[model samples]
Target: MAAVGIAVVLGLAALLPTAALPCGALQPDNTTASKLLGTWLYVAGAAQFPQHLLELLLIANGHLQVEPGAGEQELPVPQRVAVGDQCLTNNSTYFEIAVGNTTLVKHAKTHQTVGTLMNLSSEDVLLIQYQLQRERTYLGLYLYARNLNVSTERREELERYAKCLGLSEEIVYAPWKTELCQVRDIEKGNSPCREPAAVVTASPPPGTHRPGSAGN
Candidate 1:
């Protein structure tokens, strides 16, 4: 009778809801770092703040290239985005791996934004959450993929995750028809569209929210 009682208690404990952990807590590892070494396309994003949401809405399409930085502590990320009729490129930003999967992105040694990397159900999709001013209350969630677009299931998953994060249900999806700026063109400064002078700004202009905009 005592053993049966213990078993029932254990089963009840297992059935009880556990406290939800902050996103990316204890999830980053060497495998995740390796997976982030290549390029990823921005799929959709949501934010708790309106400024961040506006930033996401302005982006037609965006591409991010992640490269291993000095040692294992840093990852250099270059990004190019098509906003309106102009292409904006920023190559001076890098993320420093702060304990575990937490990252601190710095631009021109000025702005600093804290973020975390979380892997979703699909291997091709990655979710990044940027905390506002180091607080979780106001944050933005951006989803990236190895491919140009993700499936409806993946988008639904993002919506669920956003809800869990207390972000707005309205997600801004980058249009698929917009031509993404080529990395080579961006590097060569030869894109046909109006190319802006590379600036040290970590986040985009007000309107859509972007990753690494925590400090902004």
Candidate 2:
């Protein structure tokens, strides 16, 4: 019985992290988006994995979600956020994501499905943008930023959030930056034959996995 008890404790220990992790930001539009939400990534100029960033695509109605690359999905994961701005139901009240020195505000009474604004484009496409502040962020890690256009009245709020976090719209010419580069194939130790995505950031949440690793 004692042995069985120990095993059960261990099991819970392993699961506790995941269980305790907030499904997402407990509050709406406070922290990040829902883990169950869709996310777009920017590819590096070469072919690196860690150099990927958020793209300008938007996930609707919570159909898609963000999960670790490999099944290696570990415990103690960051709580997925559920809210955006104040009115958006999906927005979380967790970490206050700031862009450009402004904190996006939630509407007094409204819920806009469109997420953070990434940029202004005619493509009619919505994507989330990732960003980092050189002054605030560490040399290795970067704070994830959202860059969705949000075509509704919520556009201003979304942009405010972007500015608060020091994140800006994905510029056509500018690309994401990171410490890693797509030098070798990362897998076979060879060079990449073709170019990867134009934007450079990290994959599977930067620092989560390395390029070529089973996670990547």
Candidate 3:
């Protein structure tokens, strides 16, 4: 039972922006500015029936990183790319959660609502603290900073939750790509290395030779 805070301390953002955002968006809305930096925590792993495994991914600086799961024991925390107050518009996932600066770190940034905050579709990232007309009805969305250990706890909880929610492991796109894994998968294996599409010539001993091995 290593304290999860160890992960937080390691993930701390050493580079805190002296002044976040461009000179342009400055005014009174710099609140969300502090929310920008730091490596966001994401699902370390997930639990799906019949699959018997799960993982969580973190995305930052154009890099998608992943944390593996602890087998069927428990899923780790849920963490991901949508950890700003930018009101990310449009995206999809099996489910979403809302958490903030953990006992580990703090959120010092803030942002403003640039457009309609609601009606977020698959492409919408609900990461903004919205200003709404209460009577009129509105849901303020805030991009959350979740625990890195969420996947494990989530898996443990969901085992019983799925039954309560009337949910099944038969979720479509269950094994979605974590940002890191996606990058890794594309990087592995040469697609056509087993056989080259085109071959020119090779140095050989007179006539007996290998294709490119000098004996071609």
Candidate 4:
């Protein structure tokens, strides 16, 4: 069984495209920025890199709450994800809207990820093509929606978009069976499902403001 699993992984890695294909970009503007506000549930994801694909496989379900930050260009994103039996929460990362509809997210001041909003057929769905740099470049696509129940047509659309980006058709969907972390519990710092060791909290940079603060 172990050998078969390794073989399957290696086969998938070999199928990855060496270079990413061109895809339509969503121009960043006030209208687009406003659309990003509020809560979004993680529906599905696809990736060109094997490591990122593995990361997507681990997420059973997740959601993100976006709020306006101190600056107009900054968006504070509070994220919660369920992995296996553990729930992980992070409230420090911020997404900055950059030129060309691209968003920059800094993770613990360690590695920066650049994500470009992609044009999707459905207005209710948001598709982001992202590239993360660490030792090497990793490319992936994230699909978020206002509601958790996604249609079959939407899933098909995502598969087509993934193919256009030179990513394999094997998209991973977060199971809806898992309950999302409650906002009230998160605010009170007493979520029942939250794993103590998995909790990640950090202060915003000196000039920035945290979500739900008066400065926001």
Candidate 5:
């Protein structure tokens, strides 16, 4: 976990700016900034989801990065990418997500609201809803823990949220079985990638590739 923290912090610093304004109307609100600064594991999603299974994603310092996973039942190895994020307005209800690497990683830029749920209910409990559009689109509502383990009550809370959203049982699954996953430190000992000077103005809506690859 300590390693995860160090890696996440470094990644955020290397990739994100203080305030990212993709559109001229976007603002720098700290409400979402305060709530979204930490590591989030991918616990569950809609059926036919596209993100890497067992993947741990971190949101910090107004940036987003991928914690590479050990792959799922079929995926042998998973790839990752870094992202820059910012609030859409002062209210912090909406956020913008852009790919850190355009050539190496696929960018999800077709939509403006990459993150729907960013509030932290407790120190350890974070409930979020986002959309993923690959060839097809799917909604991902996830419960994230600050650490690897969460209370049973917290788990139930996530389930309740899933049910409330009308997510089917078969589509929802917790990818983490043990403690926090052992993930690749994407920011450790690597040359800092070039940060985008201005936010991307054209692309498809933000979406992630499936469990095996980082997207086409």
Candidate 6:
């Protein structure tokens, strides 16, 4: 009986992390694809995996590209891919996703489902969440916005979402430095691949929690 009890405890321990995670808000059915087009900044984010700055541009009926800067090593070359024809949805804002090229896979080995939740939880924020192992695994969550700098209330709101999703540990602040961010607005017909300027400022050093990372 003691041996069985120990085994049960171990099983529950492994499951606890996932069980405690929050489902986040649901995507309303009325939401449409046009609502997602814009130039979004990487102000704050949380995940079970490493977090960093990633600027995203959602082009209407075109491509969704990203530029990562700040916090860690320079981001992988900007990823640009055509949005899938259909975004898979389950009617809940929490699990809904903006589908991406379904042909791409991680390490070219495992099939992955990439999706984004637009205006989820708040209109000022967008979430990109991933699922693997046939949608049974929730990998990570990214929070992006139009403003380069995050307000205190908005930062707290991101923290709350991270906590709810059980990603507090992986949370890292990607300080908003104009030089290190994609300051262009594509919605205004700006170029998506403009080279970032090399301007320096007195912003907080990287790895330090800014108001955006929910603060240290």
- For 1-216, candidate 4 gives per-residue lDDT tens digits of 000101111111212232442777665766666778877777888877565566667667766777887866778776676655555556545677765654555443433444556777777887767654334445678888988777888888889889987886789887766654554555565664532322122111111121222221
lDDT at position 85, candidate 5: 28
- Which candidate tops lDDT? 4
Query: Positional deviation of 14 in candidate 1, in angstroms?
Result: 38
For candidate 1, lDDT tens digit of each residue in 10-82? 1111111112325433255666557668777877788776666776677777777788777766787766777
lDDT of 6: 0.31
Those runs of model 6 whose alpha carbons end farther than 4 Å from true positions after fitting are: 1-22, 49-112, 116-121, 132-138, 178-181, 185-216
Tens-digit lDDT string for candidate 6 (121-164) = 45665555433222233344555665545567777766666666
Q: Tens-digit lDDT track for model 2 on 46-121?
A: 1112222221111111111233322222111221111111101111111223333222212112211111223333
Candidate 5 vs. true structure, TM-score: 0.42
| Order of models, best TM-score first | 4, 1, 6, 5, 2, 3
Q: What is the lDDT of residue 78 in candidate 1?
A: 69
- Candidate 1: list runs displaced more than 4 Å: 1-21, 98-111, 134-138, 183-216
Q: Against the hidden true structure, what lDDT does model 1 obtain?
A: 0.57
Better of 1 and 3 by TM-score: 1
TM-score of every candidate relative to the true structure: 0.67, 0.24, 0.19, 0.68, 0.42, 0.43
Q: Which stretches of candidate 2 lie over 4 Å from their true place?
A: 1-155, 169-204, 208-210, 213-216
TM-score of 6: 0.43
lDDT of 2 at 102: 21
Residue 154 CA error for candidate 4 (Å)?
2.4
